[model samples]
Target: MADELAFKRWKSLEPGIRKKLESNVFCRKCGVTTIVDYEVEYTNSQFTLKGSCQKCHGPVARVVD
Candidate 1:
């Protein structure tokens, strides 16, 4: 993502939305909550949160509004 948009979107995301997303993500394989490692903020097409399971280190993703 471009730096400008990235910065702008980061600021635009409400704290409640961010926290909801952070708590909602889970590892599909592990079936457990994950720690968000990176996020691809809202764009035209892709919106994702990437992280690893706190217990298993399995990769996980969740779509965010």
Candidate 2:
């Protein structure tokens, strides 16, 4: 919930694209893991997803340009 506009933009993406983004987050503790309970943030004309790792529930983030 960091940025409502960013969240809405993320929601506007196709389901397949969104799934791809969500499932490929790199978690330092868990390697590549699906992201869950994420929030969207927009900065520097890019989208960043901050969330938890699906496997170990550790913090995870991914930047989408």
Candidate 1: misplaced stretches above 4 Å? Answer: none
- lDDT agreement of model 2 with the native: 0.92
Model 1, span 2-64: residue lDDT tens? 745754676577888777666667776666474556645556654666666666777777766
- Cα error, candidate 2, residue 39 (Å): 0.3
| Leading candidate by TM-score | 2
lDDT of each: 0.65, 0.92
Steric clashes per prediction = 0, 0
How would you encode candidate 2's per-residue C-alpha lDDT over 1-65 as one tens digit per residue? 35988899889999999999999999998888999999999888788999999999989999999
TM-score of each: 0.61, 0.91
What's the lDDT for residue 18 in model 2?
94
